[model samples]
Target: MNSITHYLHNELPRINAFLEAQTARLDPVVRPAAEHVLGAGGKRLRPLLALVAARALGCTADPYPMACSLELLHSATLLHDDILDAAVMRRGRAATHVEFGRTGTILAGDVLLALANRLVADYDIPRLNAVLSEAILRTVTGEVMEIANVRNTAMSEERYYEIITGKTAYLFQGACECGAILAGCGAATERAAHDYGLNLGIAFQLVDDALDYVSPSEITGKPSGGDLREGKMTLPLILYLRTLPPDARQKLETRIAQDDLDAEAARAIADRVAASGCAEATRDAARGYATLAAQALEAFPASPERDLMADMLDLVLSRNK
Candidate 1:
């Protein structure tokens, strides 16, 4: 196996064990649902990023507790986001809100958020606290803005970038920055790590949006064209809107505005998008961001850790689900 793959092979089980152990300490009211959600597997990518970042920066101290906070925070967001999206499946299983009532799911998310905070606080690092706080604020703001802008055909690319950066990039920045801080790295190194993570996050989300049009429920663990039905215009769809003739584009916008979407309508549009090369265009955009993500590591010296980050950029751009 390559460096990154080999590393994950060894560390994934240990990381999962750590997370499963923490589930027992959650608030009693939300514990069962929270455990169920947590048990459903994910790549745990955010925490994995933090851990690799710490090692890349030559961290001597144990960074697992601090790094794992990102996973907890990310899971909490999944619980809350599923409610807002009315999503049925997450990580190939029922969403927390489906298994537990909405209130219970929301409370479980809150408990996870509190637990994440406590994990960071135990390290006694002011920068870590501030990073986590800012990530939370920005992520919530982005989600609120997304809700406000649903089915907006006229939404500008700049505005879309801003929302996605807030929602996705900030949390990634926090994770990498926390890793750097825990490693006792200097300011310049921390900034490099921050920039790498921001670009990586943008690339990750771009690919995810592209796959929504093309990937099926079996492969992706979520319904294909879920965003189309929800009337969310991601980068792929937005890029497609720019190519259509005026009348055709207007008709599509009108259809997207329909109060009740049927399966046929959603499927037709998704198929059109897939055939139109919009998904490939979106992947191209992700490649640009991935290039920036890799470039951010140019200043760091060569090491197995550094090499793995380069491999990670490729992995992020290539991910289908």
Candidate 2:
């Protein structure tokens, strides 16, 4: 089994080139903002997922164009998310909103989304178009629900899963499903690919939430405790609250409810959650999902690509950013 790093090194360049060329076509005013984010380095995981799934299903032709569409879609979502989160940083640089103003940045994001639709439509595949559309709707619905439930300290673990699945997992599911569709895989194989992506995405989000509490801003490319500062109850904070005594839990909840949880308070809570071992527990939960993601890969026959898919669990579980 080749490591994801290996596949990434071999596969990401084509996706990157495709993204660069496509982004270059934006309106003159929109081009710079779009380029800024497109040029900013990311793991390119979604596109890589698409490429890997296609290869695992025995496709020989280049999948870069199709895979890059997923990257564009993911980038569009991030642009909107930064505005909603009031995020100042992304990919270790100022967020698009910070650089281009909210309106311009939002317009740039819309352009990327429109390009994604255009690219997908270029294939003239109805199933592919339908999958991407459903995924976009799910992502928007998840974001809206997340905002509506801000500071919901009593939000259940089940409900939290629903939010993350819609926002994060569904796109991953779409990426893998897209790969399968592109490769002309059988129905069962496509379902397996989707299952793999869904579980991997859930684990990825859990780890990301844990990273928000424990990783330095330099490492994560965003401030630690941003979720807490924004009043979003992620898995670590949720698990930590469960272990708290009544008085402590109430105090913590009150602090999170503030419109502005200052840096000092946010750092303190982040530290407390880290110290309470909830961070570790959150990682453990992620590991469980990673296992499920790996299990879903068992339906595929043995091959380097399938092995790479199986190995993705380790990559997702251990990633720092």
Candidate 1 residue lDDT tens string, 1-321: 277778889888888888878888766788998787788988778888899889888899888887788988888988999999999899889998998989999999999899999999998989989988998899889888888888887888888888888788888888888888898889999999999989998998888889999888799999888998888879888988888999999888888877456777787888888899999998998899989988888866677888888888888887878
Per-candidate local distance difference test: 0.86, 0.87
Consecutive 10-residue window with the lowest summed lDDT within model 1:
256-265
At residue 201, give the lDDT of candidate 2: 91
Q: Per-residue alpha-carbon lDDT of model 2 for 213-249, expressed as tens digits?
A: 9999899888888889989988999999999899998
Off by over 4 Å in 1: none
Q: Clashes per prediction? A: 0, 0
TM-score of each: 0.97, 0.97
